[model samples]
Target: MSTLALGVIGNCTIAALIDPAAALVWGCFPRLDGDAVFPALLDGGGADAPAQADGRFALTLIDQSQSEQSYLPNTAILRTVLRDSHGGAVEITDFCPRFALFERIYRPPTIVRRVRPLAGRPRLRIQLRPRFDQGRLAPEITRGSNHIRYVGPAQTLRLTTNAPISYVLEERPFLLDRPVDLLLGDDESLEAGIELTARDLFERTHDHWRNWVRSLSIPFEWQEAVIRAAITLKLCQFEETGAIVAALTTSIPEAPDTERTWDYRFCWLRDAYFVIHALNRLGGTRMMEDYLRFIGDVVEDAADGSLRPVYGITREAALDESVVPHLAGYRGMGPVRIGNQAHLQIQNDVYGAVVLASTHAFFDRRMTRPGDGALFEQLERLGARAVALFDQPDAGPWELRGSAAVHTFPAVMCWAACDRLAKIARRLGRDDRAAHWRGAADRLHGIIRERAWNPEIGSFVSTFDGSEMDATLLLLHEVDFLAADDPRFAATVEAVAKTLRNGDFLFRYVAADDFGRPRTAFVICVFWYIDALAALGRRQEARDLFETVLAHRTPLGLLSEDIDPRSGELWGNFPQTYSMVGLINCAMRLSHPWEEAF
Candidate 1:
């Protein structure tokens, strides 16, 4: 299209429409760890190398008269309609290759793009830009009459056209462009003038997406929204490793004009349970089983059973956060960051997430019967560590900037670990260990009630000795640590709403008490509020807030980590999985009220 519209349908795939022209991709790789062939996203339409180091390309779509776009039912495939001033129209479809297993695993993914003249005769222009190795390494381009190959150290990008389009290579920005004919007549004669056809690839990719979608078992009334979210979650998954990343892009700010920007390209164990829960609820368990296997392998690889909060999609743990000074951040939020420093921090809550996810897999009706002794030992080890560190100060769930404390949320999760372990032990006939787990759980519950609770404020504080209320504690009710009818639980929810709710949304915590500049509302916290509202029997209010949160989604139904209420713009990383998890969980809770057993 003449105008460029960039948005995401799934958390993993990014699609753009250039009106009356061609569509371009933003940030997506064959695998989670693969390089970005389209580095122009960070450079702002400038020349950059392909995700591999060998080839480089940039794109410019011009001479567009008018255009429109839409998705294909519940699938991620995108269709664009273009119109020229001279009464001509063309249709184009764009998607990444996802058909065969071998193709899915291979590097340098193929972009299966197809174009057809729908109404009248409209001339089309084609441009190909491939930058390798984040646009830093140059590739050797081998050009033939109709085929082109950009070879890098580890991968090769091949482009072939059936149309007679002249191709030339430019050095300064590293781009290629050519004009092609779009002939339209009777259906029989139209094929004679067409330059190139990718109908085979298009059919294969469409069938692939359709078949995968058919496997989903979504019974909710909001089936379209649920399917969109489910597809996004699947796209965010690294197919080879079964690890799902938090988001697609990096350096999108959480707050304007602050150093809060961080990369969300890696996997977080904290999301493991939520991811599995979402998939299990939606009637898809294959991906969950693969993810659990990945988790088991990670546990076995670790010298100790203890795990890091985050890691690469491939299970690599060494992620060093650094700034790329050369490129300006999104909307000039300076110092684009790659990798995450939070990887090194010790977040004890992850242990609970892992235990809960594995246990869910074991108990879920769809999953294969799990090994009792192995899972029990894993839980016992994590429980033992929690008991030993119950009183220690460590980074809280938010990964705060200062020293750690006995964070209320982690303490409650520690209680969950002990509690779930006891249940599992009893089920497996480990009476001795079950007794020990129950005793430890009782002690942890007492600690949470005595140290974390603040009767003076009538709610639990953020930390053991602090007076500030945390929105994270609202999760205590969802986790079953406190019943919704408990007066103390209701008081804590009220305190959090009074303190953290900004308009209809909620902040992770009170910003005025923190060091960073005040930011927009966290999307996940708002969903938490929805869950709290439903649990409290405020179903209508919960649905209203859920719809309001949905209104913040981008034009293509993608969500970021945060939303700027004042500007109505998406902030933080795009297509955040945690945000989607929050959405799907709230939707499920609203649909099936009795599923809140946690």
Candidate 2:
């Protein structure tokens, strides 16, 4: 008896039965970076359309019973477990080409599909459909008995079959049971096949991942979470320019009915600190070095000193947000956007993050000669910008709406900027600038302690005059603004723990005037708790809390920006890099206690 299971959501999904005899992947394209060929995942009509309408492809696996899915340890190569009811099993591995390192690179995109059946004899069925321009435009189809070519407005898609399987153009979903192999690309023919066993492929994939993971020097306790977080971090890095995106998808709401959806597909300067810290802990200094190089390139390429807070994956500073009204958002969030308009905002804190991250790189011995010089120049220019805007009001760390106010966190970050620059300048023999930066940092710290800190609340305020507590203040110890053991620090931590801690997770801030109950715990705040716990000599508690957060990771080992404490469903964008970065930082903090390391 054959039971068919079809899963359709967004522009990417897989459908198969429990036994995994045959599986179908729809909406996948030639490459991970390319647009979807089967837009059905985004629209219901595309899923019902014939594969030959344009150049869309459906992959089918046959002759298997049970199926499971996982990643190759620390890599993005997805491994699917296929087994027969009797006991035979196989594993299929899939990964898109990285940047253009492969022998054949498609201009648009191409997806690589490798199938192997283990134990018992498993037959596979494959289908290819290459849709163009979000499946809105049809392509000119050139059909052959065993091959097909689809030429579109800007790209060409070709599919060739190896096994005998009937190619039909029906208007509804159908099943293909026979062995069929096909390739989809512009001018290239991807090798497709149905192997009797996936043993060799599994072994190779396993070894590749194992070797890559072994390159990391993570401690034992945080190994699993670190590895997973590291892998997630790698997935967000655009290989072409080494720029890491904040998230993969856009329009996933931070809160239901709050209209908090924002595109996170661009690189953020704010992420620099967490990325560097995490990579440093993982002993993966290469990424930090690459980031420094990218920063230098952007500075050199830019016509002026005006820097953007975010940039495209290819290091392009231009990012204009536009909604795709044609398709509905995930779970009907509405206004599904592709690009981010946040780049247009002048976020002063980004300067501090960049300076702090560069300082981390320098101290970690990751910055090379010319890059060091470039970093110095960058710090100089950023210092000038910070000083010029130190008293001005602009978008703060939260990037809030309504008014651009003098945010406490951004001011603190500006302090970090000056502080890091002071140290670096001193090291580089620029004593005069170093002294100026140090004075600036000292004055900013004094101002924060005076104006931002609320004596009644005993914790740092969210804004300069706001009495509310912000989780971003939890980084006081992280940025060395205050000693972890300082009485004020202890008081602030206790205050947040009492007011903001919702079970193990923490809220971003507490609004004294809010009407509704406090929202779900922010995942990043939970990580901040772990950091604070570690800093406050609560090692065991920090470790336990860290594990508790890990338990919230989705079945596929992915993390969203937030999670419903009641239902435990993921909220916000899937696979958030910030969440992963927090995971990595907490792990490092737990593994290496501050007292001993600092």
Per-residue lDDT tens digits of candidate 2, residues 1-598?
1111221111111111111222332343333333545543333223343433333344433444456776656665565666655555555555443322255211233334454456655544354444666555667777666556778777776655444435333223233333222334455543433232223333444555566578887765667778877766775665446677787655666666555667776788888888878887787766667776666566566444557888776676777877767655444445566677788887878778877877865566544533355568767787777766665687667665445767777787888888988998887788997898999989888987888878777777767876767788788889898999988887888877887787767877656222244466678888987898789998899888888888878655568787766656667765688899898888777775444654
Task: Give the alpha carbon lDDT tens digit for every residue of 402-496 in model 1.
Answer: 66677888788778888888888888888998898899999999988999888789888888977887678778777788889988887888899
The TM-score between candidate 2 and the true structure equals: 0.83
Best by lDDT: 1
TM-score of each model, in listed order: 0.87, 0.83
Model 2 has an lDDT value of 0.63
Steric collisions counted per model: 25, 24
Where does candidate 2 stray beyond 4 Å? 1-66, 82-91, 98-109, 117-130, 138-140, 144-147, 159-186, 190-208, 301-304, 366-371, 510-518, 592-598
Q: CA shift at 255, candidate 2, in angstroms?
A: 3.5
* Local lDDT at 443 for model 1: 91
- Deviation in angstroms for 161 in model 1? 2.5
